[model samples]
Target: MFKVLMIEDDALIGDMVKMFLKEEGFIVTRKTNGADGIEALSRFNPDLILLDWVLPDMDGLSVCREIRRVSQVPIMIVSMKNKVAERVDALVAGADDFMSKPFSMHELIARANALIRRSKLSIGTDADFNAPTLSVSAIAAAPVSAMKPAASVEVPAEEKIRLDVNTRSMRVHGKHVDTTYSEFEIMKCFVNHPGRVYSREDLLQTVRGIDSFVTERAIDVHIANLRKKIEDNPKEPKWIRTVWGVGYKFIPM
Candidate 1:
C-alpha cells in the first residue's frame, strides 16, 4: 500500500481527507502542523505528501523546501490559495503538484495516483530509461550513449552533455552539474529532442505531467535556471535558445 503523509492544520479537513484516502486503500498518516509532518519524513517515509499551504508554525513553502533538501518524494500542495502567483510559488519551492481547497475528492485521488505513478517511473530500478514513455525519440538512435552504465562512461570534453538515468545526474562538458528535479527533467526533454522547439506549455507538461498547477511562465524560470547550470553564459545561452515569440529549443553540440 502507498503511504501518504498529510500535513493539514484543520482537524475536520484532515480527518475527511484521511478517511477518503484510507477508503481508497492508501495508508495515510495525518499531522496537524508542519513540524510533525516534517518529522514524519524519516519516521513514516511516505510515498507521497499532501501538504497544506497554511500551517500553524510556518508557511507550506518553507516546509516544502525543507523536505526537498532530503527527499524527492512527490508533494501536492492542498491550499485555498488559488492565485496564479501562489501556485507558481509552490511549484518553485519544489512541489510536484497543487490543488486548491474545496476540490473534488475524486480529482484529488486521481492526481495523487498520477503523481505516485510518475515518480516510480522516473526513478525505476532499471539501469536504463524506458525511452518510449519519456517520448525520447531523438535520442532513440543512440540509446547506448545516452543511457550508458552510470560508472563506466567517461564522456569526452567535446561532448557538451550526458545523462545517467540511474543516477538522475547530468554532466556538462564532462563536469557534474547540480540541478533540481524539475530542471533535470526539462533538460532531459531538451536533450532528447534536440533542435525541436518547445512552447512553455509543452515544457511545463514535460516536468509536471498533465495535472500540473503552475502557469507556463514557470517554465521560463526553470529554463533560465537550467541555462545557468548548463550554459557558459545564461544571458546568451548557446544550447537552450529562445525562438522569439514562440518558445525555446535545444541546440545540441
Candidate 2:
C-alpha cells in the first residue's frame, strides 16, 4: 500500500480525506500542523503528501520548501485560497500539485493517485505498480509510459533543449535551468511533440490535475517563467511561441 502524509488542520476535512483514501487502499497519516507533518516525514517516508494552506504552526508553502530540501516526494496542496497567484506560489514553493477546498473527494483521490504514479515514473521504480482506473476528465490517470523523454523523438542537431527524465531536470544551451515540477511537466509535453499547439486548458490539464481550480491564465504565468529561463530574449521568445487566440507551442531551435 502507498503511504500518504496529509498535513491539514481542519478536523472535518482531514477525517473526511483520510476515510476516503483509506477506502482506496492508501495508508494515510494525518497531521494537524506543519511542524508535526515535517517531523513525521523521516519516520513515515510517505510516497505523497497532501497539505493544507492554513496550518496551525506554519504555512503550507514553508512546509513545502522544507520538504523539498530533504525529499522529492510528490506534494499536493489543499487550500481554500484559489487565486491564480496563490496557486502559482504553491507551485513555486516546490509543490507538485494543488487542490482547493470544497473540491469533490473523488477528484482529490484521483489527483493523489496520479501524483504518486508520476513520482514513481520519475524515479523509474514503477515497473510493478498497478494504479487504479479513474473516471476523471482532465486528471484521469495517465498510461504507464506517459512520461517518456523526448530523446526518442527526432529533433534537429542544433536543438538546444535537453530533458533528463531520470533527474526530472531540463537544460538549455548546455546550462542547467531550474524548473519547478509544473514547468517541467509543461516542457515535457511540449518537447515530446514539437509544434503541437496546446491550449491554456490543455496545458492546465497537463500541469494540474482533473478540473483544477487554477485559472487558465495561470498557464500564461508558467509559460512566461519558462521563456525567461530558456529564451535568450524573453521579450522576443524563440522557443515557446504564442498562437494568439489559440495557445502556446514549442519551436525547437
Candidate 3:
C-alpha cells in the first residue's frame, strides 16, 4: 500500500482526508503541527505528503523546502491560499502539486493518484502495460535489457523535445529538469505542439486541468521556471521564447 503523510492542523479536515485516503487503500499518517510533521517524515518514510500551507508551528512552504533538501518524495500542498502568487510560491518551494481550500474530494484523490503514478514511473516502473511483446506483471518484471538507450538517441536536429508523461518528468537539451506537476503539464502541452503560441488563458486552463484558481501571471511564472531548467541562460532563453505583447511559444531547440 502507498503511504501518505498528511500534515493538517484542522482535526475535522484531517480526519476526513485521512479516512478518504485510507478507504482508497493508502496508509495515512496524520500530524497536527509542522514540527511533528517534519519529525514524522523519517519515521513514516511516506511515498507522498499532503501538506497544509499554514501550520500551527511552521509554514508549509518552509517545511516543503526543508524536506526537499533531503528527499525527492512528491508533495501536494493543501492550502486555503488560492492566490496565483501563493501557488507559485508553493511550487517554487518544491511542492509537486497544489490544491486550494474547499476542493472536491474527487479532485484531491485524482491529483494524489497522479502524483503516485508519476512517482512510480520516475523510478522506471510501468504502471500500465499494453504491448503484446512485453508482459509487465510488476515493475521488477521489466528487464533492463529491454529498455531503450534514450540518452543516446539523437533528437531530431530541428528541435529536441523529451517527455515521460507517465512520470510527469522531462529533460531538455540533455539536462534533467525539475518541475512542479502543473509546470510539467504546461511544458508537455507545448512540447506536443512546438512553435505554437498559446495565450495565457489557454495555457492556464490546459495545464491546470481546471479553469478556476489561476491567473495569467501564474502562467508566466511557470514559463520562467521552465526556462531556468531548459535554457542555457534564463536571461536569454532559446527554447521558450516570449511573444512580445502576446503570449509564449516553444521554439523547439
Write down the lDDT of every candidate, Cα atoms only: 0.79, 0.77, 0.73
Clashing pairs in 1: none
The alpha-carbon deviation from the true structure for residue 1 of candidate 3, after best TM-score superposition, in angstroms, is 4.9
Ranking by lDDT: 1, 2, 3
TM-score of 2: 0.71
- For 1-253, candidate 3 gives per-residue lDDT tens digits of 8999999999999999999999999999999998898889999999899999999989999999888766778898999898877887987787867899888988888888777776675445654432111111211233445443232232443334466544445655545566665676677556655667888978877645322345677778788888887778999988788998889987654
Please give the distance, in angstroms, between residue 212's alpha carbon in candidate 1 and its true position after superposition: 3.2
Q: What lDDT score is found at residue 63 in candidate 2?
A: 95
- lDDT per residue for candidate 2 within 1-253, as digits (tens), equals 9999999999998898899999999999999999999999999999999999998889999999898777778889989998878988887677777888798888888888878876776545784533221111111133435533233334344447776666666667657677766777888777666667999989987776555445676677788889988888999998799999999987766
Using Cα atoms with residue i matched to residue i, what is each candidate's TM-score against the true structure? 0.81, 0.71, 0.66
Error of 1 at 182 (Å): 3.6
lDDT of 3: 0.73
Better of 1 and 3 by TM-score: 1
**Reference-based TM-score, model 3:** 0.66
Q: Where does candidate 3 clash, by residue pair?
A: none
Query: Any runs in candidate 1 off by more than 4 Å, and if so which?
Result: 125-160, 171-181, 208-210
Best by TM-score: 1
lDDT for model 2:
0.77
Distance from true position, residue 4, model 1, in Å?
A: 0.9
